[model samples]
Target: MSNLPKTMKALVAYGPGDYRLETEHPVPVCGPDDIIIKTEGCGVCVSDVKCYHGAGRYWGSETEKAWVEPPFIPGHEFLGFVAEIGENVKGFEIGDRITADQILPCGECRFCKSGRYWMCQPHKMFGYQNTNDGGMAEYVRYPKTAVISRVPKELPREKALLIEPYACSKHAVDRAGVTNEDILVIAGAGTLGLGMITYARMKNPAKLVVVDMIDERLEKAKDFGADIVINPSKEDAIAKIMELTDGYGCDIYIEATGHPSSVKQGLAMVRKLGTFVEFGVFAQETSVDWSVIGDGKELNVLGSHISPYCYPFVIEHMTDGSLKTDGLIKRTFPIEKWEEAFEYASGKYGDFKVAITFD
Candidate 1:
């Protein structure tokens, strides 16, 4: 505490498409129920890309409410060491390695009371809302109510940063309710999609197909235990899936591609009464035929939001090498080169995950 600096570098998002690096941002003060963390690294997520592109979900459309209040930092997936702890903060000490759930639940909400804190009505996401600054800085304050966990000291930096996404992916796979007889298809081979592959593989389904536009990502999917990888750009994905399924269609279709077309494609490729799990966050509204979900196929549509109570499981799997993290983190940059980091994360170089590092 004696050597702590008064100010530190942070990246602040001023508006929909405006993000700036601030070198003199104030180091957050620990409240009675909060703790200050010295950020080690923060991963750039697809949600961050959507927020950067001024997606309606973050900026709001005519029918939606904007959730992001700018002038706030924009990182949620991160790991750090506790630099300072409040008097009332417990189970954590200075220099403890920690990471927090991005969604800060209001314990009083109906969802929270029902044990579904991930869907709490008044939740404040660490990076998007004004209540808490994100980890795209030297320090981030973890509110008392936030679900915090101590990361294993032996975990590699890249694997540690994957905890959040892996948790979310676990939620998605669990929601899919996969079985040995089921033929599953996961659309997209990005971060979340790759994580989905890791968890879905554990189910030992009859067939596990991965769809991606990039050949490199598809190849990585193979390394992650994907039975089949489809390059949508080079092949008619729906036709191929139909042929493989003998026109019966796949039993489970998980959409992890943020592209709107993937939704329609999933609808077209899923068998009747099959489960369709939508896990991606789209940048805009996507309209599809309603009958396909009701009268036509009677598909079971499930929505996976964020990691709820699956963090511990994800951490265990990551620690045990069940979830491979070797090729996941493609690049890392100092917090000062946030613009460059964002650019690389934006898919200009077909990178998987990009992280901003401190020191």
Candidate 2:
């Protein structure tokens, strides 16, 4: 082994409104069952903006109370190749292509033992804190527990980077319990919303209607297999769905936009005995009016957190090209141009799913 540097260059946040290109960070070390991976690609997600910009802090940790010093790496959703493996690491070797779950769970926790590692006690996340430095840096170390699955040789790095959000959508679909005959409505045509569209299409629903504030996103939704697209800004989304469904609303209404108003709209748009899935991540407190569901609507509202038990399913879909993602990835950037990537992904430059590619 070469003598590795104790510090490396990484894009670090000094504080709120304070991000800079910096170096001299200690490289994460591998444990007995850990694996060190050299990042191949990283995606710029909206959650990253919430943490770096002013919307909210990552992991709900106060800015001043964060563990690592200012200027830490950022980017949890990524794909990489194994650079090194720990002594006890098996079933994987150096040069193996893989994507991580980004969630580090305590295997001893009851939730983890029960195959609910996503809800692991003392849960730590990559790129959110020191748990792992994440892919924004040159390399990251992860205990075997974090490795989700090996990336298929046919799956491009760009598509593999989508596994994280895809797992999220898969979890929502699993919880929503959409079947071949169910009518479904997805609110918000953004990345997460689009992922829902892609995954739900696998179920071959009777009708898949997508509602978005932006026409462009609605168009993207159509490309992702939404049977009908409605721009809520120009039309009454709920009324449109009702008319399309011949007065009865969709059997499943999913709220992918964090805006509470959209959630409320979904509630009003779903039919009685329908399922409402909440997949959006709200940065601030939100409120909803329940009167719409007061008259025995027989509604099933499910709150979905980060993914669990769906990594393999996501990987399979991505590998087979059944879920087309290239249309969803709007831009790619070199790791050095992360700031530009962030700007493009923030909707400032009219881009979606911007990814950072490492040489």
Candidate 3:
């Protein structure tokens, strides 16, 4: 009904060190097939840390590197209201609430056609190392394909903020092939690990053990329904996992911590033929015990990049009250205070998922 302003506030990353609260940014321009969203909430993901702190070097992709551009906005996990929908856009209207998938694939790519859009030859990521400015601002511009789903009216913005990360955890669980009979072990009780624990509980696993070095996170894991919580700092985690599995080892292991040692240990804690799904991003050149993996242990190693077809399922479960977003969300910050938000999310403030809210 009125003309929008040209400049807007954003949390901009100049190069790589940290984020700054910037107010002099042009609102993103949209193409005929694109939509502009007025950001409502943006979750601070660990990948934001990797991108800004150079921990994403392991990805080895020029697109990613280019996407994580200097002097850019940074927040992929977010929900927003459709501010303006370009002509030709269908099924969505201005003022509609929605969240983004973050990782967009070229539908024409062979990998995408094969249903492995995460591995698309020309992959496009949001608020990462190489795509476009993210939602840590007043507005975010996106293509129609990037929109995952509309937010439920019953879901709080804070709870809706968990959608992206939840989608990721869902993908990891799906890859692990979690079943009621499987003994699920999640490495790292961080946000992703915690979500994995919570979502894993929905599958009614026979046993669920979450491992973390920090007591607070372990407690959070417990709150999320982990049957057993292990503190590696005080005890042997691998042995504890083995004991929990009755010396048989866990049937499925999900690695949500980026530490290489944890990855190697996750591999070790799996049953002889168990599946190991990696949900964390390890730094460049991080080595693993491939020898054991290649020793014909029948190990299945899966690398999940966000979620391809898991969004709808996550939304359904969340809408049906199967996946709980409470407790997992720590706090919220106004978009103007994005620096403080990023700092809090980077573990400087505390262990929690710090989200930036527009309103």
Candidate 4:
């Protein structure tokens, strides 16, 4: 503990489209019930991109209040080693590899009392508010109430970093209720989309289809066990899906593309009584036909939020190699190159996931 520095470098978000890499930010103190972590790596998420572009869902829109308050570090998907353990904390030792559930639920909330903590009214996420400084830095503080799990030492940093996103995808797949007889279509091949494919494949679905505009991602999806890969930019996606499903369309559609058009496409491609799981964070509102969900198709639409109780399942899968991680993390950058890393992540540039690593 004597060797620990008083301050560390951190990426602070001041407001929409405003972020600064501060070299001398205070190293968070470990409260009696908190633990400090030395960040190993942090993955960039699509929400981070939306926040960077000043999307109203994160910043603020006329109808919705903003989720992010400024002057806080901005990273949620990360893994690291325990740096300082609090006096009252138990079951964790110094140097233990760990990653936490980003959402900190207020146990007193009604939803929390009902065991639905994911819907806690006053929940705080690690990366969005000052109270819980995020992992885009040399260190981060894990609150007493934060749900944390230890990572196996055998797991590579790149794969460990995927646990969070994979938990989210797992929850979406679970919600979709996929079975061996079901034909599943994942509407994107990005990190989360690919994560969905990884977990959905485990269900041994009759067929797993992946759709993406990028050929590289489509190929990667095929390598990741996708039975079919579609390049929507070149092929007529609706027509191809109909032909593949023999005009019945897909039994389940998982929408991971944030583009509004994907929502409409899912509505059009899913068969009557089919299930649709919406897992993307959009920049703006999408207009779709309400009748298609009710009278026209009677489809079952589900919304997937952040990782809730599925962290352990994801970690277990990653530990056993059931979840493929090779080539998922395409690039890594040191904290000094945050701007470059952020631009590369935002551009997508034919990459799956980008990470910021600490020395």
- Candidates in order have lDDT scores of 0.89, 0.79, 0.78, 0.88
Residue 259's lDDT within candidate 4 is 87
Ranking by TM-score: 4, 1, 2, 3
| Candidate 1 stretches greater than 4 Å from native | 1-3
**Across residues 38-155, which tens digit of lDDT does each residue of candidate 2 receive?**
8888888888877777553443356434433344577888878888788898888778988778687878899889988888887777776655567787777887678458888678
Q: For this target, which candidate reaches the highest lDDT against the unseen true structure? A: 1
lDDT of 1 at 321: 95
Candidates ranked by lDDT: 1, 4, 2, 3
In the range 95-121, model 4's lDDT, one tens digit per residue, is 999998879888888988898888789
Candidate 3 global TM-score? 0.91
Q: Select the stronger candidate by lDDT from 3 and 4.
A: 4
Show how many residue pairs clash in every candidate, following the order shown. 0, 2, 5, 0
TM-score of each: 0.96, 0.92, 0.91, 0.96
| Candidate 4 TM-score, C-alpha based | 0.96
